[model samples]
Target: MRRTVGAEEGDKEEEEAEAQYHSKDFEWEELRAEVENDPSFCQHLLPFQPTSTSSSSSPQAQSDSDAWKRFHIRHSAGKFFKERRYLLKEFPELASCNENSKVLEVGCGNGSTVLPLLRGNENIIVYACDCSTETVERVKEIIDASNIISIKQRFHPFYCDLSINRFPTWLACNQCRDIYLQSQHKSISDVTMNNIMDSNNLYLLRESGCCNGGVDFITLIFTLSAIPLQTMPVSIKECFSVLKPGGLLLFRDYGLYDMTMLRFELEKRVGFREYMRSDGTRSYFFCLDTVRDLFVGAGFTELELEYCCIKSVNRRNGKSMRRVWVHGKFQKPL
Candidate 1:
C-alpha cells in the first residue's frame, strides 16, 4: 500500500522538502570541505580508527545509555503516541494497513501510535519491541486492554538486544545451514547484504522473550535519532536482518536545525559539530548524504529521505517555532 499526502496544504510540504534539500546541501558541502582540508575530521567520522579505541567503549557508551534515561524523563511516550495519530490520518495508506500483515516497531514506546494504529486496521499483526522494558510493558498493556481483537488480534511485545541467535535446526538442515553460514560470515554492518538470509536469527523456534524475525514492515518512529551515529550501522544491520524481501521501513526523527537540536546546542552540554549529536548520543542531524550514507551502509536500497518541519507562530508572544523532523523510507530489495 502507498501513502497519500494530506490535504492540509501541499505548499508547506514543498517548502519542507526544499528546506531539507538545502540543509543537507549545506552540511555535506561543509563537511566535505573540512575533510578535504583536514584529515582529523575524517578519522573522527570513522567508527574504528584506534586513535581512541576506548572512545567507543568508554564514557561515550555510558553517556549514551545515561542520556536515554535523562531524555526519557523529559519525554512522555504516552503524549508522543497521541501526537503521532496524525501520521495515519495524514497518510491514509496506514488506515488500510493490514492486521495480519506482520509489522515490527523498534523502540515501541508507550504504545501510542501502534496501539491505535492496530485498532483501526485488522489484518496487520504487529511484533513491537523496545530496548526499554518499561516501554515494552506499556505497549503490552495497551494491547491487552484494547478491543481490536477481531482483526487487530495479534500484537507481540517484547524486549530485545537486537542480536541474531542461530538455532540447532538451522545447523541440521543443509539449506538452512548454508543460509545461516552465509549470514554469520557476512559483515552486515558494512552495507553489503548479498546473502543476508543467513545473517539473521529469523525462522528459528521463537525465543521466550525475544522478537526473532517474521516481520514484513518496520516502523522506527523517533527511535533512530536516539541512537549514536556510530551505532546506526549496527541497528540498521539488525533491522535488515528481520525485514523480509521488499519490506518497507518507515523512519522519522529529529533533523538538523531542529528546535531540539538548536536548544541542545545552545545549552552547550556536550560536543558540537556538523553531524554529531549532543548528549553523548551519536545523533547525526542529517541533511542528505549523511542520511543516505547511514542507510546505504546498512544495505537498504530504495530510499526516500525528506526533511519536514511543523511551524507555528505565537501571535501574542511574537515568537515563531519550527519543529524539524526527518522521515526516511527504505526497502530491502526483493
Candidate 2:
C-alpha cells in the first residue's frame, strides 16, 4: 500500500511544520535584496515567462516554444537513467510484457529510459518523444552509435510536444519521412503506406502496423513537471487518449518541499508549486493527493501512489540533504 524508498527518523509533525514555514512568502524588497547580494542565489533564480499567451496560436506561444528549445539545447546534461535492474525489480509489470508489447517514454532525454527498455527486451518495441528537437537528435545519435541491429529495429524516437494533442499529426509526418527514406533502397512496406493513408486516426495508425499499438506502457519520468500547470490536465488526458485499454502510466517526479525546492528563494517560484531553475527550465513539485487527483480526473484508476523520501549525505561536506519524490502507477480501465 505504501513504501518508503529511503527515510530518516524524525517527528512527522515537525517536518510538516518546517515545510509550511519555508513555503510562506517573503517581503518582495527583502527577497530581491537577498537575491541581488548573492551572485550564486541570483544565478539559481532565473526568470521564466509563461510559454503561451493563449491556448490558440500566437506569436507569444511560438516565442515561448523557441525559448524552451534553446534552453534544452544549451543545458544538455549527459544521459542519465535510474537503475534499470532496480526499476524492473520494483515494477514487475514492465518485465512481464509480451513480444508484441509497445512502450512509449514521453520526454525521453537522450535515450536514457529508451535504451534501458530496449536492453531489457529485444522484442518489445519502445517509442520515445521529446519536445526538444536537439534532445531527439542526441537520442538518434546514441542509437546510431550503439551499432545494435535489434535496438535500431525496435526503437523509434521523434520530436513532439506532448502538452498538446498534436501527436497524431506529428506521428504521421514522422511515418512519411520513414517511408521516403526506405523507398530510396527498394519498395516501401505496405504498413508504411497504410499509415500514410490513415494518418488522421490515432487508433487506425497503430492498428494498421504503421505505428506501435496504443502503447502498452507510458513513462513520465520527471517530465510532466516541466509543463505549465494549466496544461498538465490536457497533457495527462492526451496520454490517456494514446493508451490501449488496461494500459499503465508510470510516473515519478519531485515531491513538495524537496531539498531542491527548499533551496530556492521565494522569488524563484513562478506559480503554484512551480519553480524556475537556473537554466530557465521549470519544475513543479507534487503531493500524493494532487497526483492521484490528476490521474483520476483523466479517467485512470490509481493502483499505487506513495511519497519516497530519502536522505543523502555528502561525506566531504558533512551535510545531509533530504530528497522527496512521488511515484505512482495508474491504469486505464479495460
Q: Could you tell me every candidate's TM-score relative to the true structure?
A: 0.64, 0.69
Q: Can you write out model 1's per-residue Cα lDDT over 112-145, one digit (the tens) per residue?
A: 5576567666667777766656666666766676
> Model 2 compared with the native: what TM-score?
0.69
Highest TM-score among the candidates is held by which one? Answer: 2
Tens digit of per-residue lDDT, candidate 2, span 1-334: 3332322111111122122111123232343355458776544445554444322223222433455687657656533332233344345677788886888899887775666577666678888898888888877787767665577778888887876545664333455334333333344466566545445454455566664445789988778887766678888987876776678999978876566765776655666667765555677888788999899998889998866655555444656655666778999765
Candidate 1's C-alpha lDDT?
0.53
lDDT of each: 0.53, 0.64
140: Cα error in model 2, Å = 1.4
